[model samples]
Structures are given as C-alpha cells and as structure tokens.
Target: MNSPHNPLDADTLRRLQEDVIDSYDEELELEVDDRILDGPAGLSDEARESRRVYFRELFRLQGELVKGGAIKRITQRLNPRVCRVAALPAPNDREKTQWYFQRFVSHLPAAGEIVLFDRSWYNRAGVERVMGFCSDEDLEEFFRSVPEFEKMLVRSGIRVIKYWFSISDEEQSARFLARINDPLKQWKLSPMDLESRRRWEDYTRAKEVMLERTHIPEAPWWVVQAVDKKRARLNCMHHLLAQFDYHEVEHQPVHLPPRERHEDYIRNPVPADMFVPDIY
Candidate 1:
C-alpha cells in the first residue's frame, strides 16, 4: 500500500536507484559529499559561519548539476545576446572579470539567446570594485570597455535586459535561518553567502556603481524588490515574456488514419503468461 504521506516513498526511491544503479555504478561512487552549501546569515560581530566551507562545495556542486531553464526571446532588434549569467569567479591580481569576459567573448554569437541566471559580462561598480577585486585601473578599464560593448551589442541588434534581484541582509538572514532548519533545503548553504552578508554594504555600494555605469537607455536595467519570491518570479516572467512578439505558433491537430484504415490496428494477441482469471 502506498503511504499517503509519501508520494515517492523511500522504498520507491530505493527501487528507482536499483534501475539507475547499473548505469551509474562507478561514477556515483566517485560523487562524494562536496558540502558546498552557503552558510545561513549571521550578523553578530562575534558570530562566525561555522558551516560555510561545507556550503561552498555544495553550491559548486549545484552549479554543476543544474542550469536554469532558458526562455527564448526574439525582438524587433535581434538582441543577439539576451543576458550573461555566471557565478563570481575567484578574483585574480590582474582582473576579477578578465577570465569572465574571455569565456563570454568565446561564445560571441551565442548558442541561442543567452539568459543568465547570474550575469558575468559586466563586473559593474558594485560587488567587484567595493570588494577590492580591482584597483582604480580595473574600474577605469570596465568603464572604458562599457561604451564599446554596448555599441557592439546594439549594432548587432541584441536587446539587453538586466534584472538585479536585491536582498537585504535582514531578509537574507531570515532565508538563511529557514534553510538551516530545513533538512531538504540545507543543500542551498554556501560560504560565499556568508561573505556576501559580511560585506552587504560593500555589495550595495558596488551595485550602485553597477547601475550608474551599466544602465543604458537602449537596454535599461530593471531592479526588482526581490523580498517576495512570488512577486519576483511573476515580475521577471511577465517582463521577460513581454519582450517577445510570440504569435501563437498554432500546432495543427494530430492526424489519425481514417476509421476503416485503422480497423485492424487493434489486433489483440494473448500473452502466453496472461493467465485467464478464475471464474467467481
């Protein structure tokens, strides 16, 4: 009997594992607990995120396993590039974004429209500069490159729409607490999260620069008050979907053979093991 409390019960999970185990045998064993979850938010001057390192590994693994679903966009202008998404990289002495730009440039005329879950194409004035990823030279370089990149993208007909979902330290703290308490969601923990909290003001200052430096008339950035998840999801989807003029691609009804043509299609064969039911 199925447990009402469990749709995909542990027994079912075990069985499903059995089916996939043959295919996954050795690689599954190699998959160790990276424990890369971002630690929950804590702001007491003395409070340290003990669980941070574990979460960083977890978040890294998550980056490996899932890439968010992309919605295709085609505008009057072609907006060849939709948006660039990426996790902030390990900052180098030379550049926080040098490697990022290199990778992004490599995808020039992207696979399709690029819709980033997190954007890397621009380091902006916010996070990178505030966090000291670059000296004044790097900031100058980013500003220097900004106009040309925009011009290139504009000339190419790639419409750019950037959405920054901002979360306050207090709000993030609540979310972190929820994650910490919930076993199922514990996987979302990460060390970067702690760093982000510790330097919230720095990130905010950086974001302000990001807004000023990067926000262009041709491709305006929309700031969503991401305090509410439902609102944020709805806002993003509504805004994104609005950009495309997707006339209903009418899918014609599936055709079926004429009644007479398919009359023999139901020829039933008795299975040798199909035991005839015993009469009551």
Candidate 2:
C-alpha cells in the first residue's frame, strides 16, 4: 500500500538503496590503490615502506572536501578519468552551430560540488587546433574569448584551477609501447592517439600558444611535470590542498540502534540451482 504523493514505490526505493550501497563499496576499493586511506591521521611504518604517504594525503584532502572544508580534490596522474577521457565527445552539427562554450556549461558544478574535467574546453586550442578540426579563425576566437569566459566563471563563485600534466616524448613513447605490448591496456590505444603522437610538434606549439594567451589572473594554469606518475599525483594533490584553507569537521559520536525482531518471522532460502557455481 503506497501513498499517491510518494512517487517511489518499494521496489524502486530498494533498487536505489542497493545502487548507493554498491557505489560506496566500489569507492572504498580505491583505498587499496593507495594504502594511505586506512587512516589519514597517522602514517604507519608499513605506509612509509609502501610509500603511501602521498596517497594518504590525497585521500585526506578528499575527505576534507567531502566535509565541506574549503578544499576541492581532482586526481589526474595516470588516472584517465582525470584527463581527456572525461571530456565531451566530438561536437555534432547542431552543437558546432551553438555558442562554443554552451556544451561545457552544463557540466559546471553547483555550490560545494567539485567538478573535475579530464580535458576541458581548451581542447579547441590543443587537439582541435593541432588536428585541424577547427579553423584558424575559430582558434583565434577561442584564444580571445576563453580568458573572459573564465573570468566570468570565477566571478560566479567557481574556482577555475587549470592543470597541464606535461610528460616527455621519451616517456610517452615508452608508455605507448608498453600499452601496445600489454593486452590489458590495448583499449587505451586509439587511432587518434597514434595520430597525435605523429603530430607531437604541432601539439607542442598549440599548447604553448594556449598557455600564453589563456593564462589569466582569475584562472591561472599550473603545469605538473608528469614524467613520474606517482610523484605527479602526490605533488598535484599536495598543491591543490595547499591552495585551500581547510579545517577538520567536528562531528558527534554515533551509537548503533538495536535491530527490531519478530518472534514469528521465518527466513526462507532459495533452491540450490538458483545460486551461481563458485568456480574460484
């Protein structure tokens, strides 16, 4: 028996609850990626041996951000989600005709939410310019307008922190070769990536111009030397945390309530065939 005002039925509510629990579980597994997540308050001897201090600090920063501390955490180094992969796909005919920044506007974070862009609108200055996807006029206009647009975003209470993860040619080459050899990483190799590698000089020129023209006081760029991925992650996270003034949240202690019980209730089990075989 559901009320008309309650839009979510029991089944729908159950599914939503399950989805949230599953997502939390998945987020927790990232702790294994950097063992420092166990306790940000203390750096154990094991953490020191594993060089987990960097990761621990990163997780701590993220926790502070979650607690409404004046911080925003965006992890990028070696993490594709922090880079170009998070950007929108190629513009369709209609999108191209609209305002250049229209598509990106929707992705902007609201108050207190930290929106991390893998590759931002600067794609026009970087990839699009180098790949000849945009005209010379388009490139010039983007360079001219981006500073003003960023200033507007900043004025609107948005913190526009830009980062350019710079890695060497030799390092990139080695990474590409490693990916080619590893079956697990084969999906990372795309025709566009291969083409980009060939046009390295063009990209370098575009990057230089983009940085020079769009580097405004309101939204300055921070270049991260990303030859060593781990160091880059640590350095970037540390820098971001330093830029903010954050304090730990004071929370009250929690007590678990006892579960309700019904003496007449009985639990039922499904048939053995309903279970999946555990080969492992």
Tell me, by lDDT, which candidate is best. Answer: 2
Worst 10 residues of 2 by lDDT: 69-78
Identify the candidate with maximal TM-score: 2
lDDT of 2 by residue, 184-220 (tens): 5679899999999998898898899889998889999
What value of lDDT does candidate 2 attain over all alpha carbons?
Answer: 0.69
lDDT accuracy of residue 86 in candidate 2 = 42
Off by over 4 Å in 1: 1-100, 108-114, 252-280
| Candidate 1 Cα deviation (angstroms), residue 121 | 2.1
Output the TM-score of candidate 2: 0.75
Candidate 2, residue 87: Cα displacement in angstroms equals 3.5
Q: How much lDDT does each candidate structure score?
A: 0.53, 0.69
List residue ranges in candidate 2 displaced over 4 A: 1-86
**Candidate 1 lDDT trough over 10 residues, lowest sum:** 68-77
